[model samples]
Target: MTIHTGHPFADPDPDPARRLRGRVVGAVTLWTAGDRADRTGLTVTSLMVALGPEPRVLALLDPDSDLLAGVRETGRAVVQVLTWGDRQLAEAFAGTAPAPGGPFRQAEFVATSYGPRLATTTTYADVSLVGEREVGWSVEVEATLDAIIVGDDADRPLLHRRGRFHTI
Candidate 1:
């Protein structure tokens, strides 16, 4: 059977009017230091690339989101790049069925200067929140990278695309 996907067009940044349109893809992680030293996190369906290696990461959070308060109070955050096997961990932190009960006992993790973060799946980086700006439905945060956790087997990455995870 022939599938009909609409016409494909060239992606171009023509002018101011045609600009500002953004595409959504992937499951970039949202993490913060919770009330305790435990890490509080969520899987944001919508994540964006604020800019490149002055290395700023931006996320939009609901005004009353649990993590919104976490970021505001802590002024620091961590972003973990997930692998496919990490779907469960992401779901847990995102408050899915088996929510994070206490300090993420089920998964492997390590204690950091700011908080505890996942030790499984892949890499993580600690970032310091520099500022925030209101943007319609959510707030845009600017953060700087401070520390990085790398593992020997972290070369392969799991990516979320069109609502599923695949090896990359």
Candidate 2:
């Protein structure tokens, strides 16, 4: 066995689609669902909001993620926008960092009708599942925005790009 350091994807032939996706900067958000004992969350970056008489949220989630399973069972979810300080929490949920006692133990979360929401996140939305379909290697979930809480725009949002976190 050999120990290799540096970037994991050192392959010469990289997928152009994946490279393009890595270039798209997006806000780091956490989507949570289910009850306290069985709650699950995932760090998501591929998401968008559509405004209209009935606003909506669209997110690309891992098809086999526990968060998606929870959402499917409960039909509700909480989407919380993370701040610059929440990078570690994001990593925990993303399964990229060591979370000693599960990801939820990494920070404080408050119980909501939809699910557990990050206590420090002032910007969040409670959504109900509308529909979902297989899109590429992900499950594209469409949800109706049932309620929204906007935070101060002055707060620096945690952004993800090129496999790294950024602040803006």
Candidate 3:
């Protein structure tokens, strides 16, 4: 296997928008949907939470991702925050690293009403799809927060920026 020691997308002429996005640090989250019989997940960093009478989550998901398909089919999903220790899990879900027997097999998971949640995750949100629209090259998903669990800030949150993982 060819091991790359440098940035994977180190190009002479990179997309300005992608380059700009890379500079914005974001917490890594794993969004999972579907049931035990059929499940799919994706590592997401481009997301935001809006608070109001009804709190909602806004996430930019790949148009063709299985996670997106599962969410559409099930109408519910679990969004769990990943810790620094979950770097490998995040990479596996992101499809940037090899995952033997699939990414779900790489770690322990607990089934919830929405879907499977990482067993080690202390912070997560159960959401139901509110709406969606095509935004840029991605599908912007809007989901209402049905439930939320906030954990104490003991462990560092996994972050992504500049095509690399960081902890803060």
* CA lDDT scores, all candidates in order: 0.64, 0.96, 0.96
Candidate 1 Cα deviation (angstroms), residue 135: 2.3
Number of the top-ranking candidate, with lDDT as the measure: 3
Better of 1 and 3 by lDDT: 3
Q: What TM-score quantifies how close candidate 2 is to the native fold? A: 0.94
Q: Write the per-residue lDDT of candidate 3 for residues 1-168, one digit (tens) a residue.
A: 889898876786878998899999999999999889999999999999999999999999999999999999999999999999999999999999999999999999999889999999999999999999999999999999999999999999999999899996
Best-first order by lDDT = 3, 2, 1
**Candidate 3 residue runs with Cα over 4 Å from true position:** 1-9
> Candidate 1 lDDT, tens digit per residue, 8-87?
45444444432432323565463756544435666665565455567666666666666767777777766777766777
What shift in Å separates residue 129 of candidate 3 from its native position after superposition? 0.3
What's each prediction's TM-score?
Answer: 0.68, 0.94, 0.93
- TM-score, cand. 1: 0.68
Ranking by TM-score: 2, 3, 1
